[model samples]
Target: MARCPKQRKKAVIAAVSAYLELLFNFINLLLRYYEALESEQEQAVEHVSSWETPIARQLARNSFMRCIVSHGDISCTMLVRMNCRTFQKLCMLLRDEGGLRCSWNIEIDEMVAIFLYTIAHNEKNRQLQATFRRSGETICRVIKLVLRSVLKLHSILLRKPKPVLHNSDDPKWKHFKNCLGALDGTIVNVRATKENQERYRNRKGTIGMNVLGVVDQNMEFIYCLAGWEGSAHDGRVLRDALIRPNGLKVPRGYYYLCDAGYSNCEGFLSPFRGQRYHLKEWGGRRPRSPEEIFNMRHSTARNGVERAFGILKMRWAILRETTWFSTKMVTKIVNACYLLHNFIRGENGADVFERLYVDEDPDEETEDVDEDLILHIQPTVEWSDFRQNLAQELWAARSWITS
Candidate 1:
């Protein structure tokens, strides 16, 4: 193996170079393996994420389905404020008539259920998101869509008033022939911008909108006007309603019974001022005067509107509280509530909300009419005489019954 010195040096250099080359190749292979492993991990993570989304969505949908189907009708009513049958019918109406279509992930029934649950319970967006297993944006969009759909049914939902006929045998309305309904204004809470808050501040010093509602003897709303500032007098609101082209319409002879807050105009009847009115004032006591007798009967007959408002507020919790929507949206919601109320009353023979009001008077307090405020439409002399004659006739009828 002995060799020359230069030859041996050359052989050692070649061996060292070969070793360095082999080391470089081995390092390249290790880098390629590491990159491949990292790519596989990323693909695996993407697959899991994509797979979990649909699974989670499916689970949420299944849970909602179980709540609707397996929980029974009581739970359904408790959740959405209506029986299952009514809920289904409402959904069908919205789809068939209202042009409501289902979203990719949510069904028509689920969309309606979301809206009903939100209004019935006044649930917040976050709560709705959690309950419906949707994002907050999705929840808000669904609410608006369903609200529009429900409002589209207003024409059918709002009842057409049938005046009390002359041959009416019902004691509550027999005394007042050709009476169309009862008209009153209620203050519904609303949240407005800082600049508009003062205008909405009512006499009670609360931010609200004065809602004018006209309901028939059956407690069905015939007309509704909402969005007037609370500080606006009821008389002022009524005046506006009268002037609007599509506003409250009164037949020539038919009249609506109103509290003294309204003027005793030609088509509106108001009880005598400076006299004891309201049923509570005459409870368990005989009417001492003809005026008192008239006021008692007037209050009893007009109680239908009050009870309708009570049942409406009780059924929909959103009406009882300040809504988070904009002023315009709140007005729409108020109208939608009225429409739903009429629909429920017309469809259901037995209403749970109405039952809760049996033998119970509404909590709304009556305020004295501002004579000066209502001077524009002064009490017509003819209508005043008619009221007096009616009062005298009622007094005589009471005496006859006693005798």
Candidate 2:
């Protein structure tokens, strides 16, 4: 049964080769399994994503910046800074909440992007609309719709005047005795498009928009009107302040402040005539004395309306002009901006003009009694005369009622 040495050696070599081959095949199989496991694990991670909200659920800047810019931040193109989810929500709100959608199924982001690019940045609608895969008409409609929503939601953000709280507490505004808010006029310039050039022309002899706004001491817009033609005076505009039955509210003893553009008629007040815009003019070497220094301090505090206008116009360049917004939407856009301004200030601490770098006048000139230029003053109603007449009527009426 013994075998030859050479044959045994040959058999051993064959076995060794066979073992090496088997080991190689086993390693290959393990490699394939590991690769498949990795693939499966990746698919699982993709499919089994955690359902909870991501820590980075930030609101898109557009949804927030539009409001902020108008009342407070006064920045341009806040759209680029927003998150995708928030951008989508804004598109949905404009489309769904505001019901502004066109035939193209243009999304909210595209629409908002169009506005931020066009109106806020003063880019042509055709150019911006094209970038977003939308038509110019769609862009126009989108802008109008947003303006409408802004107007619709203007009062929603207003902090109700807290009369119950004492006047001494919130020095930012005028409380109980009188003063609902501030009143002011702003001109929104527009290119004289041939279609309705005359209709848009204002007293300034330019085709522009005239808007009247009322804001509280906090600079929150309480009410706004945008329909008046540019030629309308501030007096006529103020008369209609109490017109809107539901949207407008003015409690008794509450009034507003405006410049000489408005009459000091029954419900409003202005600086004393021969009044210098800056009361410091009174002490100057001018012929006539001006208002006291305290008046300047008070007027400056009440002049938030001018600040609001500057903020709005500077941020949304279109606001400085007659917006292509529909006439009805004109008011809404204005209201919305004011409302959002307030919202951003309250929620985001947005300061519209500070961002714009509004400056104080160091050598600004004030009118000192120009003799050649006659000062037209608003006729005042003597309180004593008015009250005596009112008292006589009351006494006579009482005797008649007694009888």
Candidate 3:
């Protein structure tokens, strides 16, 4: 088995050569496997992209959905929705007065359309996102921004309650020269958590918010107080309205015609409790007494507030539906609606409704004045005498009618 030294050396060299060749082969195989994996990954990426929609096409679709033609469809009903020209005026106010043009570069027309659509249809944020071709976040942000902007116009939109001059010769208002306006409360449907449902429920067994409002002769809201519990009495709500810093303020010699739910105090005049007060009850017959005549006239004047509320509810469906908003937010929205109602009435006049009152068109049905629900506040001696004297004056003014 002994070999020559040269032969042993050759055999060792051969084994070494074989081991080196095997290591080189394994390295080449690994390099080829990595190259194949990278090629497969590139192909998968290309396949995925081939099925994707083009960015330009998607943008075109969004533009078509939010085009001017779409807005025209909205404008068709803008009169009943936002009382006609009010929608345009509101957008101008936000863009110019509220500084929205500087703060947010969103289109002013689109902003107004979004806001009115929300109120008129009572739409949710997600629903608006789809309709406006905007993201949910943008829809929410725009709504909040526009709402605050509209509220900034509150001071100017709210008209100051002015007294009728003694020498004024307007027949419709000459009879009640000292009257400031009509005051009343209306129930607006709302939504709340189960724990708070009982507190928000009214006598009608529905969740609601009690909204107290005062409207001038032109059907413009002078003062609005919202957020009261639905279960609270109308008189209690009025008391709270009086205590607020900007609450109702009746100047001396000016009174508001209210319903039986309010106290017949010096600043507020209510109809005779035991007598017929509604115009329907009179039914074309002459009043039997001075008190009956006063009640008839009081009912006629106080109807301004009811007509305002009716038009308001008809314009904004949000007031009629149960909104999925917190009670506080709902209150703010209610206040915004009142301010907008005043803005519309001031800008467009009182043509929002064809016949606001039942008496205006006897064929039209309207809200009846509730004379049975009496607040138990005892009238002051001076207050009682003032009402009695007012009734006598109204009766004495009948010389023109009788003649």
**Number of the top TM-score candidate:** 1
Tens-place lDDT digits, model 1, residues 1-403? 7999999999999999999999999999999999999999776443334335767766876788667656877787788877777788888999998899997778899898888888898888866765776777889898899999988998778777677778888778889997878999998898899999999999999999999999987888889999999999999998888777677777666678999988888889999999989877876888878898999899989988988999999999999999788889899999999988877776665788888877542201123222322213557789899999999999988944452
In the range 229-328, model 2's lDDT, one tens digit per residue, is: 6777776665665555443454433345667667654445554454466534546533222233324434664667777777666656667755554555
lDDT for position 355 in model 3: 47
Model 3, span 92-162: residue lDDT tens: 88777776653343566677667767887889876665465566687777777778887787777777775
Task: Return the candidate ranking by TM-score, descending.
Answer: 1, 3, 2
lDDT of 2 at 102: 53
Per-prediction TM-score? 0.82, 0.59, 0.75
Judged by lDDT relative to the true structure, which candidate is superior, 1 or 2? 1
User: Candidate 3: where are CA atoms >4 Å away?
Assistant: 1-76, 83-85, 101-105, 354-378, 399-403
- lDDT on C-alpha atoms for all candidate structures: 0.83, 0.54, 0.73
lDDT, candidate 2, at 178: 41
Instruction: Tell me the lDDT of model 1 at 317.
Output: 93
Backbone clash tally (model 2): 12
Summed backbone clashes in each candidate are 0, 12, 0
